[model samples]
Target: MTKKVLVIEDSMTSTKVLQKVIQKAGYTAVCASSLYQAKHLFDQSMPEEFLCAIVDFHLPDAPNGESIDFTIEAYIPTIVVTGREDEQTRSIIINKNIVDYFTKGNSQFYEYLSRLLGRLERNQQIGILVVEDSRAERNATVALLQRHNFITYAASNVADGLAQIGQQNNIKLVITDDDLPDMSGIKMVESLRQQHSKEDLAVIGIAYQGRPGLSASFIKSGANDYLTRPYCHEEFFCRVIQNVEYIENIDAIRRAANTDYLTGLPNRRYFFNRVNAILQSPPAHISLALLDIDYFKKINDSYGHDAGDAVLKGLAELLADICRDYQLARFGGEEFCIFMPLALSEACQQIETLRCRVEKLRIRFEKQILNCTISIGITDIYEGSIDDMLQYADKLLYQAKQQGRNQWISSDTKHRS
Candidate 1:
């Protein structure tokens, strides 16, 4: 369901702008011009339908941020936008349990607001671990993170922190204090580095204000960033977001490297890496098959290359849907591969079903409805190397093409019509 963001502002111009920004961030905007209207609208709808509320710090009806209080009391995360740009105003807004506050000064404010909205939506899926020995400080940190919609885990010592990190795979960032019961924060960072790289997991160390060289030690021990004891709300959230974004950016780059650009499927390199990992502890019965479109080039020659690409994309979607349980990839051009950890008979049945589905698939390009079929070569040989298995499958594939264009050939069975 599309989550809604309640916009409570008095100015018509600001309300329109906020509505556009919220919609651009992939959310619905529910607008209210005053505190009373906001209450009425909110009462008409369920509170769970709202992701958060963006309220004006000063409204005509409620001039002292009463709407902000109202939203917070209703258990909705609130973001304050005010025209006041004084230090006193900032202190008052930040003291409340709000997501963040913004000054209506320039275009940059709205830009940052857009980014913050996106971050709030993404934070729902991310987990963070806080390691601090003090119960009060730990609880305080967890509460702050919860306000931003993050899944939070707390540990009172290094041993518990390490255990939680091992158990929780979604934890992307770890914030640890300098003093812990089991070990020092620097030592904990070192231990964590042994198993996870800086790109895979981000660590932030916290030290007192007068701790000389402690920040340096944390960085040297593989912490991505560090924080001081008297950190404010803004500084703490800034450091946490920066470290988390570092890990996320690296993940995006790695995914782009492993994914095919055209069909959004795994490329040949990623397929080999995945199958090789599974091959380490080889399955009792494994089968590999290579599939090729029967007359892919003819489509390009008759219709155009665009039509050929449409057919390839259509087939890739079918392969993804049907072979979701197995390892599959597009091995360049018209060739695709599937590795199934099943017996030869079972693999044959699955591949034959896929073949029939492809035969019936009609891809529409411009005004033409094009139909295509696939030829498959399968083998269940337990070869030591993947290269050898692929070579065997390729030979069978060639034989299938020679005998007939739309048929399958297997090493242990006769060619089927």
Candidate 2:
């Protein structure tokens, strides 16, 4: 379902601003001017539809943060925004069961809110493991994570925590207390680092304030971050978010490096890496196909370059859809490759189907209805290396193009039109 955010604010200006921020963060904003209006609007929809609620601390009719109470009572994670920046206002909002509170002091507040909303959405997919012997502490940590919509797992000891981490592939972050039953948290962090790099998984170690060198030990042991036992909620969240974002940013960078910029397909380097990994075990029957768009330069000359790009993207999308069971890549301009663990006959049939589909595809660009065809060369011969397979496939592909456009040629069989 497309999640929504409930914005209860009396000011039209603030409501409009919040709506823009929420929409930019990829969520719909349901706005209300007062608590009564919020209730009426909320009654028309299900609570589950809302990702969270952003409410003004003081509404005209329901003054003094009553709207915040209503949202909390309705079980929606509430984020309070107040013009009052006093310590008492901050205290009152922080004590309540809310996601976070923001004081409307500067433009950075909305900027942070935009980021926070995005984090809440992403947190739904991120699983966090809490490892603490104290049930109370573990529950509290889990509760805080859940308020931000994270998938949470709990373990009472280091051994159980390690087991959980191995079992739960979705777990991206581990928050562990220094004192554990099976092993010290620093030791656990060190053990975990042997298997999971910092970019793959993040660990935050918690040590009591009186523990002089424990925090530094945790850091040296490969914990991404360390938290003090008596830390405030704000400090705790900052550390958690910092560590999580570190992993996510690294992932984003890796993906960018491996992906083709225009068509969003795997690039040549990534394709080789994947095919090489598969070649290590050597499938019983392996096939590779090199495809080139027929008359690609002609298309670019007849139409605009934009239309040519549209054709490339359309072909990539088709390849992704039909070759879901195989590895695919855009090997450069007007060229693509697919690696399949299928016999020559099976691979030939699939490539023939793909060629026919490309011929039938109608790519709309501007006022033009453009169509293109692909010539494919496929080979089931795997001579130890992916490079050898690619070269053989390229020869067959050239033969297909030489014979006629929109046809598939197999190394072990006759060319098909």
Candidate 3:
């Protein structure tokens, strides 16, 4: 489901900018210029429908934080955009149960709002592993994380920590104490580093006072960060937030590297790596196809490169909708590839279906509706290599283009309906 955010600000320029930023971050923004408008919008929509809301401290009608109070009254996770940072204003906003408040004094505050929204969005899927031998300490740590909307798993010892990490997927951050029942925290960090890289998972060690060289030891053992015991709750949250943000940024970079920019599909590098890995233990029944858009250059030459891009994106969406069970990739330009885990006959039928779907796909490109079709070449996996299968599929693809466009050719060079 698409996430919706409510934006209530009186400044037209600021409202437009905030709306643009929110939408660019992949959210639907419902904007209102006044407290009355905000109330009407809130009443019309279910309160639970909004993932979160952003409200200005001063509105035209509600000049004194009334809008913030009203929005919070709706049980929405609210974020305040206040031009004031006075002690009394800060205290009142903090007590209002908002996600967070941002000062609009800085020029980069809007960008920060976008970043905060993204963090809250990702918090739903992020899991933090808390490993502490002291049950009280473990519970306290979990409570703090949970207050910030993080899913937490607790383990009493290093061994249990490792076990929990293995069992829980999407566990991105681990908070561990210096001492553990089964093993030293430093040793556990070292062991964890061997299994998970820093880009995907982060480890922060918490040490007590009088533990000389504890922080250094944890760092040397591959922990990303260390916090001393009896620390402030705000300090602990900041450390955890920074580490999680680092992991998320690195993961995003890795994803971008593995994906095609134009079509939002896996790129050739990912395709080759996955296919090679699969061939190591080749499945009994497998199939692969190399698909290409027919007369793609003509589309670009006649309409524009933008139209070609639209056609490619349209085709990618169609393929994604239909090829849920297959590994699909945009190999470059107008070429795409799909790997099917089915028998020869089934694979052929699936490809024929995809071909018909592509034939019927129409994309509205500035001033005109563009119809596009694709030619596909498919082959069943043999007792040979991935390269061999790809070569066979490419050959069949060539036959498809040679005989006619907008059709598929299997190993038998026969078109299936």
Number of the top TM-score candidate: 2
Superposed Cα deviation of residue 118, candidate 1 (Å)? 1.3
TM-score of 3: 0.78
TM-score each candidate: 0.93, 0.94, 0.78
Per-model C-alpha lDDT, please? 0.92, 0.90, 0.86
Question: Model 1 over residues 229-265: C-alpha lDDT tens digits?
Answer: 8889889999999988899899999889888888989
Cα deviation of 285, candidate 3, in Å: 2.8
Clashes of 3: 0
**274-358 in candidate 3: lDDT tens per residue?**
8888878877889999999999999999999999899999999999899877788998889999998888888888888888888
Give the Å shift of residue 213 in candidate 2: 1.5
Q: Which stretches of candidate 1 lie over 4 Å from their true place?
A: 301-307, 362-371, 415-417
Give candidate 3 regions above 4 Å deviation: 1-111, 158-160, 381-384, 413-417
